[model samples]
Target chain A: MTADHLRREEWAVTLPSLGWLLALFAAPTLLVFAVSFRPADPYGGIGAGWTLATLREMARTPLGPVIARTVRLSALTTAICLALAIPCGTCLARVAPRRQAVLLLLVVVPFWTSFLIRVFAWRMLLHPEGPLKRVLVTVGLADPHTQLLYSEPAVLLVMVYTFLPFAILPIYAAAEKFDLALLEAARDLGAGPWGAFVKVFLPGIGRGVLTATLMVLIPALGSYVIPDLVGGPGQDMLGNRIAQRAFSDRNLPQASALSAALTLAALAPMALAALVQRRPPALEAAARKEAA
Target chain B: MRRSRWPPVVTAAVLVFLWLPIAVLAANSFNRSRFGSSWEGLSLRWYRALLADADTWRALRNSLVVGVGATLTSLALGTSAAVALHRHRSRLQRLHYALVYSPLVVPDLLMGMSLLVLFVALGADLGLGTVYLAHTTFCVSYVAMVVLARLQDFDPSILEAARDLGAGRWTVVRRVLLPLLAPGLAAAGLLAFTLSIDDFVITFFVAGPGATTLPVRVYSMIKHSRNLPAINALSVLMLAATFTAVRASRRLLQEDRP
Candidate 1:
């Protein structure tokens, strides 16, 4: 009725894995964190000496506006992606099983190609004389040459397109595992459809929501590609701004400061993911397994 | 529950909407006279132009080097970690698993930037090597997570039986462990290749003077001239190549799915 206590031998196999991860993955990040506190070059005050100036400088500058824009765009993208994905997952989960698999494959088809090509395809769509332009002109929405590329809306659209798969995949996983009877129970207990969903179904999808929000938020925020090319020159975000300072401005100090800000910002979702995964349900499963 | 076509209808519509830009770019690639989208007639002239372009070749080579290099590194590091973790159940095993998952959670930009700083402080030359290191750091974790998921139901008893039947650790591993884990390893490796080839953010941050990737080149072109036929042709070519590989990988993984 139980695993052999001689399973102690298994511990021998697993220890080195912890060592390997710590050495390779954890060590590198530790190095990054350590170096972040060091001065990039010390011309401003400490003369290439150690300084809090970098961390302090994070709050200053048009950096606030820059980061705010990045967060806003990323949040909007996450909301839109989830908004589309939730119903999409519900559809897939509730559909006939054979048909649902085909639909899921279809949703994931775009993920089959390079992300670069997918984003580039959008370029073709929004081009001046492109089909979209032709359609718009045909329908008389705007002029033939009205620029669609390099705008905030374009950036948002690309973000949604790129991340929509991320949202759907996790939510679909959750829905597949969802106990529909609880939802029916809620409905049976004088709850309307909306109430049933809010009270019974939402909690079942909680982990999926967290995972999808997380998956969307991290990339959407630091994404240099969509915002840089699609959002254009003036739409400089944290990523674009950092790349600009590093490559264009060649200001390593400023870039270092920007990099530190980005690292802290990236930690937000990561920390939340860590917290969620350690929650009672997941931890209880692990603990129960250990007790067995 | 009554089924609704509205959900599927909306989903299909959204997908088409998503593909609009791709359709536009691909459709325009064949337009005889490019200059954005002045369609004279259907022709493969732009693809010919794409094939002939020097920068295109250079970028393609750069992307291949980065992709192959990063994939190899990730497989080596990631597979080792997955194997170790698969065998290693400890007090902090869940935390250990989450540690491997951290790279998945971090933004590519942060990883790129942090690597840039880390390499700089070490006085390491900023080049393709640094780029590979950065790419490997993030990709290895993804590979580990995927592989580990595939390992959940795997039986350790087979290894014990092989050992009891007079096999050494290496022999048991070579004959028993590797064969069972082979499909998962292949999937992880293929996924890493796909991710590395498609990567823009991390590579953008960590690449040096000569490490200009295809996406970077294409990105600049999009910024300057939004409707270049060569870019469209290149996208189509890349799409074709990726589809072929993805299909092949799918077959390889699926065949082992008994």
Candidate 2:
């Protein structure tokens, strides 16, 4: 068969799914974008008139605090996840290869449980009369009436707990390929431990750290279930507001606007990461030469 | 061997933190107390209640149907997309690969809201069917990624050899590719099914009246009622099911390697 015929045949393979994605996935997002520009009706639907009221109102009051809190919480979650994951990832990489797989699996298996269920488990454990309270009482650390279930700390705790695996897996993947001999060589050549770590260790797992940070940070920003289940009444994240507008208030136009803005904001970090991760031609050529 | 002992200790502590809540959850499922704090004694009262609840069973049934439907459709779409992308090496095709995988990165809330907008615009009633479509949309990206990872190590010479031996496209696909891809497909389908069953945020947005899923049902119950031990029992069972599904998928993916 001719090359043209082969190319056509290959194109045929992608045709079906491409059509499905365009029709279902792309079309819906476009519809949401369209709705965001429309005015809301009292009858729980959008009207034909165009208005920027939703966008304007979003800039005014709750949206600013919501976005600010979301960012603050997400950044903290990412930082804490990275701190915890890096040491654990180092340990994982240092272990025997066979044991490493088992350890990694242990980290991932808990993630397979329902996200809501895990959040609920945290709610119970942090409740006023929960195990944590009892532990604190027994240790004489605090009064018996201390409540952790509905506070900012509770939300942060659950967010970190939930996203910790995402942080660990990527860092572990990066650290697994790390070379300890380089560190030894650096030391042999007269570099201090801190110097060796900064020069040798960080660069080795830099990609993994970036990947882990983005993976955890992006989803953490969009979180709702954690705050809803564990947070106090005033702890509304951007997700909670978006979801409330859509489901509770039935304000489709405003919800669409907020969701559209949130989606755009979420896409920024992913796009930047993708750009940063693109392999350089020099590295590719070096790799090819090494392979040869 | 006088290495620092901090790594192992730190790792152990992290693992404990990871598994403690789950252990507590499972333990509390059998607690006789209404609130799952104090342990009176082991009992099956909550499980008995879980079994007797018609709403729970109905929601479970709804979850299963949605899971199966989403899994099958995702498998077909994902496999085709993976195969095509594997064969093409052009820049546009590389972009296509990125687009196919974009759903994996986009947050679920955005996916749910956008799909809800689309369905409402089309005037389709919100229910299990819409939820099925939404699930399939995201699940396709997941299945495609898994299968594509497997396909990367695949040899293309086999297809050329099959064609050289006078095999038609259909014959080559059925005789060669299908058997080779069996393990990957199984792993992908299992992953897709688990995701569909575990999904809450997406399904909750799309599901209308009389179409409450297991997760949605459980969420509403938790929101409305403060102290229900039955939920703990239900959660424990779901946890067991999730573990089984993940273990099965891991095994299938391992088998795919060879």
Candidate number with greatest lDDT: 2
TM-scores, in order shown?
A: 0.87, 0.94
* Candidate 1 C-alpha error for residue A207, in Å: 1.3
| Chain B TM-score of predicted candidate 2 relative to the true chain B | 0.94
Query: Which candidate number would show the highest TM-score if scored against the true structure?
Result: 2
> Which 10-residue span in candidate 1 chain A carries the lowest summed lDDT?
A40-49
The TM-score that candidate 2 achieves is 0.94
| Per-residue accuracy of model 1 over B51-152 as CA lDDT, tens digit each | 888886898898889888878877776776777677756656677677777778777777776666666656777777877777776777878887787777
Q: Which ten residues in a row have the lowest lDDT in candidate 1 chain B?
A: B1-10
Q: List candidate 2 stretches off by more than 4 Å.
A: A278-292, B1-4, B256-258
